[model samples]
Target chain A: MRLTYVFIAATMLLVHLSASGQSQEIPSVPLKALTGKHFDTVQFNERENPVILSFWATWCGPCLKELDAINDVYADWQEETGVELYAISTDDSRGIKRVKPLVNGKGWEFEVLLDENQDFQRKMNVVAMPTVLVVYKGKIIYQHTSYVPGSENKLYEKILEYSK
Target chain B: MVKKTGLLFLGLTLISNLSNAQISGSLESTGQRYVDDNKIQLDGEDAEHRYRSNSYLKLDYITGSWSFGVQGESYLPLSLLNYNPELKGVDIGTVYARYSNKKLGLDVTAGHFYEQFGSGLILRSWEDRQLGINNAILGGRVEYAPADALTFTFLGGRQRVGLGFDLSKGTLYGANIEAGLSDILAISTVDISFGLSYVGRYEDYEHRYLNGNNAHLVNSYSGRLSVSKGGFYSEIEYVHKGKDLLMNMGAPLIDGNKKAGNAFLLDLGYARKGLGVNASLRRMENMRFYSQHDLDGNVFNRGVVNYVPALTKQYDYALQNIYVYQAQPQYQTTPKIAAGEIGGQLDLYYKFKKNSALGGKYGTQVALNTSYWGGLDIEGDPETGMYTTKALGFGDKYYNDMAVEVRKKWSKNWSSVFMYLNQHYNRGYIEGKGGMVNATTATAETTYKFGKSQSIRMEGQHQWVKDNFKNWAAATVEYGLDQHWSFYVHDSYNYGLDKIHYYNLGASFSKNSSRVALSYGRQRGGLLCVGGVCRMVTEAAGFTLYVSTSF
Candidate 1:
């Protein structure tokens, strides 16, 4: 039974590889700001520099750690690479109320958006938390999942490489 | 099966010829190999089958205004411990086709899809693999937004019950409208928004109960209002559920055992650059809505139709999670007759400026949170299922938590965090066993960075309790070799009572959009909760492998 699934999965991968070339465009989903306003995700494409999307939640430990690590050096990264980071909170109603205070309390400078129903996360094929993706020219250039302690440094490297 | 595969292949081949099409997917697999140990051992089916694995493969394609996706799940040999038994073997979990036009502000979907209306008080259809919950609706939905400030959604479907496209007997219908009044009024000072939702569950239970008084359809309606001005924001929501027959242990009872449910929730907050304060209060009375009427209050959380998570601070760390709180939104007639729950929580976050007294070299971050919950004060009889609840009152205390945390960066390479928590848990009412427990926990953690990209973090924690698992001590050490590799070891010991040590050591490798982790550990026997929903698992020891990748 397992072998059957493996064969199907391998077949699907082959199809995917055959059809892949151009960088995938960001889905035009509605992103809700903390101040209760909705905007189209395609707006990120208008920026000249690269844009980073970090999917996170309040209950996720590694997500917070990754966000905190990036928050510490966010100003420097922006100054050097002219990149903007958007920390998208995938917290449902269970922890939606905490997003505002937690973001403000930690004094993070990145723009924060709410994916209250996880529509944006699902549309992006993000299965796990702390998934970071760097977008250049409205196309996803680089992406990574599950952050370690020093993963932010690697992400910054990607940002710098793409910003040029 | 062969025909279906061929059709899917044909469809993909036809679509892949398009020059502008895109393909994306994600895969996740978790396998466990149980081994017998002297201190801890697996039991029942888990022990009999030494190897168990669960895997999911999802593929999605997009071109122009059309999109299609399918998810396949496999639980070969067996699923993980505590997963729903109905999910067995390899099968197509969900499939959907959608047509979305941004210019027309219209979206339509057919087949399995997930949706939530306003806080999910009235309706929520989603999938949580860890909880073995995939209640996506299997039907049609249409969403249209006439303007930027207003949107409307209508959906009707049967809830997915299990794998192999097993659907519920009942049908679910929902309609929602959300509007931003500020946008229409052109008011720039404050933002005002409101939403209204309606959800109905139609299940034919007339033949079984023989009670003509009970209706075949159960309806729920919710209204919400939000207004935020400057740094202050507030929101209020209310829901009223139509009367329906109450079930006792998965069986419908006659003799006017029907009851109406309602819920009220409020949130108020003020936030600025370096400080934020928020408070929430909620009251629910018999608000459990199930797609199938008889499946109410099921242990596996199957057939649940709404989302009512416990509005409490979700803490991180091992010791802090032992005394977790689960929302009480169902009628209980076991030890005592109870309606639902009423409670509130408060949170405050503040950051100290750099070079200040509280802030050393880097800024200091402080967070304080507290919450209290109790049963509703109801005057009723369990025989007839009729009750009168006080408009505002606390019947019996259920849970209380108070916690404070402080984080400080000593230098460029060192940072530390300290936390303390106090909890008062009424185990008898919440868990149906054990007495009231009063416990306090304290933890301290520090991280140091060295070399180019190497870092080490150590955490120490201890919990003290007078009753119900007396004392516990836990410690963890994690080392990050570079950007892609990390290793950690954790040990949690219950010294006072069971004297059992739950130890786990693991290493993880992560690259772009992929991660793999391997661990060996003694599993803890308790309620494993995610997003406030919990499942029970027996004590066992095993080697676990997890692999996930996404394109």
Candidate 2:
């Protein structure tokens, strides 16, 4: 009976280790670290703010609409719950030039990041554009693919639910 | 003596555990048999076997902030060239190293990466498995952001060639900076942002074939802007390039001309409540947006893309797609041309309330989309000019496509959708330089669902041609068992000048984290178009299997 107990405990430990291995926590590297820029880190662990990460390209029509819809209400959300939205452009060097002009012209006020090499996209396992991931407390809580009308509202609700 | 025995037992146990970490992989093979009854070409039966098998081993070990993992994949006798049995060999697909720190807000990646710039006009490095297109960069990249409104990235690498075809080791480099100025430029009803980027490439070419060993520099600069207020939004982009623009006329061409080109695009849209509308226009001149000056065919050239033209008609029916519009890069060089041609597209959608009798119990959604696209001559000569500056009317020139769709839900678990399309395709405009027009096509499709997991989709298509194949028809039926599994059978019959029937049947299975699909089909000779470029795929009867997994 004693030997069986030891075997059971050992099996449980092994199972726990394997499960943890598959569920890797989302990396919290500073945006500068990924871009090869030097900057001071601003950690936001205490506030537990919900983070919206969107992968898009300038050439995708659906992506443009999705971002425009969110930009319409990004300010109100910030005032209410301090949510941070990161709009990552997967534009290559050729299209990279349009990123600034297009973003500035559209009047979007969210955080912008350039994944010129798609390193972040590959890590997050993104296969298509207009992919959105919602993170809470540095862990991915929800993810949605593609976009249609009124989807932004549903995303806003998810953010509000998690923030509270 | 007891301590030695204990150590030996421990050593044996470790060895057994290591052996249990199995190194296993998978193999997928396909074979095709083609039969042709043609008078012009030798006709009979030809059989070929094409197989692609990939194997990799993953080992995981973690220590502190560092974790290590490696994956290796090889294609034995790369299946892409299987149609031509003469080429056969093993090729490496990918290998990489990645590291991330949870505490330092740092993630570093060195090795190969796949990336893209906005819409890929100026720069896009990506891969499409079905098309066998992989443009991953062999280089290093780092990203960092410390503020809510600012982000920066610096990247440098070499463009990817095909497997075992990385000879012309040209250098590609670029950097991007984006800033969100909403707080700095405050407006209650508006938000604004800006970005700047530059990309340059160096290539060494021995034009010995063209008779010179000249090195050229390919540079591109792009700028974009967007504005939205209430229900209206607009976006504009401008791209400029230096001399020796690498343009892919979809065929072989010389590269050593001091030619420069520019392109501008505008998209305007409006959406409110149950209605939406959008319009777009683009004009380009001498723009050949290629990363390498010496390359013949690149989808994204610095000047303008000729194959993947923007569609006013996104034909979903198979027949309509057969004769789709393609871009013409040669039109940019007309000596008599004045202003570059301009093209535009429009889309609209509306919804009806459910209480209405026509909408039934669950309300109906109706959408009407129509688009007309044509080229302008600018100042080109009538006889020798590449393009004329004539305004594209309902049936004037270039291409015109119109489509309408109606969708409705009958009950809690039932819904249906119907669509119809009409198109006019000009072979001359679509084929570019010395290409001819083949025919015009019309098509329709319908889909019905029973409950959430079971559904059937059907499509019908037809083409009416003045010449060439004359007419064609196709139909397909699809059934879905659940979210993870779907089965479909389809057949396309040509019944005009020559009678030929092509049939295909396939099934796809999926479970949590993995998917496997198998299909057996006969493909008739035809043009397949994506975006705006078109390619002629051979006629064949074959079997295919695809598998994918994620963790």
Maximum-DockQ candidate: 1
Off by over 4 Å in 1: A1-22, B2-14, B17-19, B206-209, B254-256
lDDT of 2 at B9: 29
- Which residue pairs in model 1 clash with each other? none
For candidate 2, give the docking quality class from DockQ.
incorrect
Chain A TM-score of each candidate structure, as shown: 0.91, 0.76
- The C-alpha interface RMSD of every prediction is 2.7, 13.2
For model 1, how does the per-residue alpha-carbon lDDT over B1-551 read when each residue is reduced to its tens digit?
A: 53454356446655666566887777899999888788997666667878888988787888889999988788877787778766777778899999999889999999999999889888888888888888899999999998878999999999998886799889999999999999979999999999999999898755456557656898899999999999899999999999977666666665647789999999999999999999999999988889987677877788889999999988888999888889998886767778899999999999998888887678899999999999999886767756789979899999999999998888877888899999999999888899899999999999888999899999999999999999999999999898789999999999999989999999999877789999999988887788877777778898999998777
TM-score for each predicted model, relative to the true structure: 0.97, 0.69
Q: Tell me, by TM-score, which candidate is best.
A: 1
Give Cα-based local distance difference scores for all models. 0.87, 0.53
* Candidate 2 C-alpha lDDT tens digits along B185-209: 5554754555566667777766533
DockQ for all models, in order?
Answer: 0.59, 0.07
Model 2 per-residue lDDT at B304: 21
lDDT of 1: 0.87
Where does candidate 1 chain B have its weakest 10-residue lDDT segment? B1-10
Error of 1 at B276 (Å): 0.3
